[model samples]
Target: MSRFFVNVYSIWAAFWFVFTFLLIFPFQFIFLQKEAWKPMAHRCNRVWAHLFFPLVGMPIRVRYEAGKPDPNQAYVFAANHFSYLDVASMMLIVDTYFAFLGKDVLKKAPLFGYMFSKLHIQVDRNDPKSRSKSLQRSYRALESGRSMVIYPEGGIRTSNPPQMHPSFKDGAFRMAIREQVPLIPISLLNNYQLLPDKKNMRLYPGSVKAVIHKPIETKGMTEADVENLRQQVFDIIQKTLDEYTANPKAHQNEFKRLTVI
Candidate 1:
């Protein structure tokens, strides 16, 4: 059944890809040239996620508790990276546009790479120049009323016991402090369940939830504040995942009960 869904979803996704390319691609080019492209890109991402993976029949629903930073305000939105779907899921409720700090290697992918390139600040982790350039671009984006979404844990990790890459990078937090933007630490739970690290394969229908925590204000903060902020964000995500993994049913019911418009 899972394999069946994967096949069906794959075909539908192909059709949708071609359709979007034929219809929306030109507009995407236009939007890319605009100053307000970030939010527009995010809105497009949400629609693509819903329509692209049809085999994953489960709908993508995002519920969030409002934070201190207004959706209108720019932020450095950081989260743990788990799967490729993370980008799509993040775009659902985040009204503003955000630029992701992605590895340069992903730019080589075919059609998907084009979309990623438009929205990402490509960084060659091994090169100092690439890292410096990405930071500069991110700051400019923030100044332009756009947010930067970073996966502080570095790369995707898929395991029963999820472990963050040792020592979260301080670049993002440092930028937030310098720019005086709020640091929004998002916790994504069960996204990996929907689409685990399947090499050369796809996944079946399953729910993906991204819980957004309150933004951590960086007003008057400095480089000294980065570690504390990083640890706090890490703890929140770790604790949330621990709870969900322990009793998914209980947590899901509780989450639904608490979720109100």
Candidate 2:
């Protein structure tokens, strides 16, 4: 499909998905039992992903270093974010129970806003207090055995395509070490390829690819080791991305459809 058609379909599908979710899920969400929302919300999100990806004509594909992560264990999934699709497509790969530490503006999105407030942890970067609160909430979530999805680069701030921003925020790594959870380096390799972070709501005809790198165990680590841990994940993902840039064809899939529970 052409770029024009892809953009048109994406805009149409996004609004439509939000409208449908508003009608069906908002009532349940408003009264969602706080402690019981994980499984309920995760099921709803998977349904949304199944509907949107096919509706927008974008196929999903995944490349896991190991087959997949154990659903029973909690993890801190750190990925590079370069496209709006990064968050949405995460549902296709992460089948385990997890919530994301996302930007505060995510709550302003139509139907997702309500769900984000109830199900995910949101942080306001400008406010030190808010960031502190979100970090506390994230630590509690990890302690309670719920995994988290965090972007190490913070957001899609890189000036150059496919290259990570020069540095990363310390929040994700800090919590991982303090909580002693395995941090999984996730590389959303195809998000920028399928949709560049440009001014327009643009898309392209392509398959999605995410590399779930081997988990880095943070046992017996402290705040002093945060940057070293951050750099370790950054190097692994950036190296895989650089290899993809050198040879994209090897990663292409003709009929492989990624499955997530």
Candidate 3:
């Protein structure tokens, strides 16, 4: 199919899927029912992927590393932020129940805002109150056996080999220490290929990979240990991504579909 037809189908599928989800699932209290929400949300991602990408012809290759951590254990999932699709990649790859620590502005988006508000940890980035509230939500999600996926870099990058900004904030690591959950650093490769940060966007089908680096045990670590753990994950993701840049085929299997253009 032509790119035009694929883009058209992507939009239609997204609209119909979100509309159908809302028609059946109530808008309110989506977070309250974590048990049902986790699996349902993952299924939503798969459905959307199959609908717009595979069916529409923008093949999505999602390469996930083998040996995922057990779902029974709650974890603090930290990932690099690139595209909106990162959330879906995480859900479809990671089997555990989790919620997102996303921007406060997402709560105001048209269709996704309401849904995102469900398990969403909206952060103001500037306001102390919003940060406090987001931290509280993160703590609660961890306590409830749901892992929290937080993007420590804050937002998307302006260039390739995106600088990670700085060491991660103490919030996620601190919570992991207090809650005694392991910190899992996840990396999403080529998610930006599907939806680049450029304006006037249309979703393209491509391979997306999420690398689940071995867990950094925060069991006995203190708040001061956050930076060290942060670097460990940063190094692993950075190094692996650099390697992928040299040889894209090494991680090609992550893409469930191949024909992106």
- What's model 3's lDDT at 25? 44
Arranged by lDDT, best first: 2, 1, 3
Better of 1 and 3 by lDDT: 1
After the best TM-score superposition of candidate 1, give how far the Cα of residue 138 lies from its true spot, in angstroms: 0.7
Instruction: Give candidate 1's error at residue 162 in angstroms.
Output: 3.7
In model 1, the clashing pairs are 9-55, 38-97
lDDT minimum window of 10 residues, candidate 3: 252-261
Give one digit per residue, the lDDT tens place, for model 1 in 131-154.
999999999999988888898877
Query: Which scores higher on TM-score, 2 or 3?
Result: 2
TM-score of each: 0.84, 0.90, 0.79
Candidate 2 per-residue C-alpha lDDT over 1-261 given as tens digits, one digit per residue, 9 for 90 to 100 = 676777676687668667656654754474455666557777777777787777666777777777689888889999998898898889877878898999999899766787777788999999999999999999999988899999978889997868889798888899899999999998888789777898875667667887888888999999899989988988998998888888877756522466431
RMSD of each: 3.5, 2.5, 4.1
Clash counts per candidate, in order, are: 2, 0, 13
So what's the TM-score on candidate 2?
0.90
Q: Compare the candidates by TM-score and give the number of the best one.
A: 2
The lowest-lDDT stretch of 10 consecutive residues in candidate 1 is 252-261
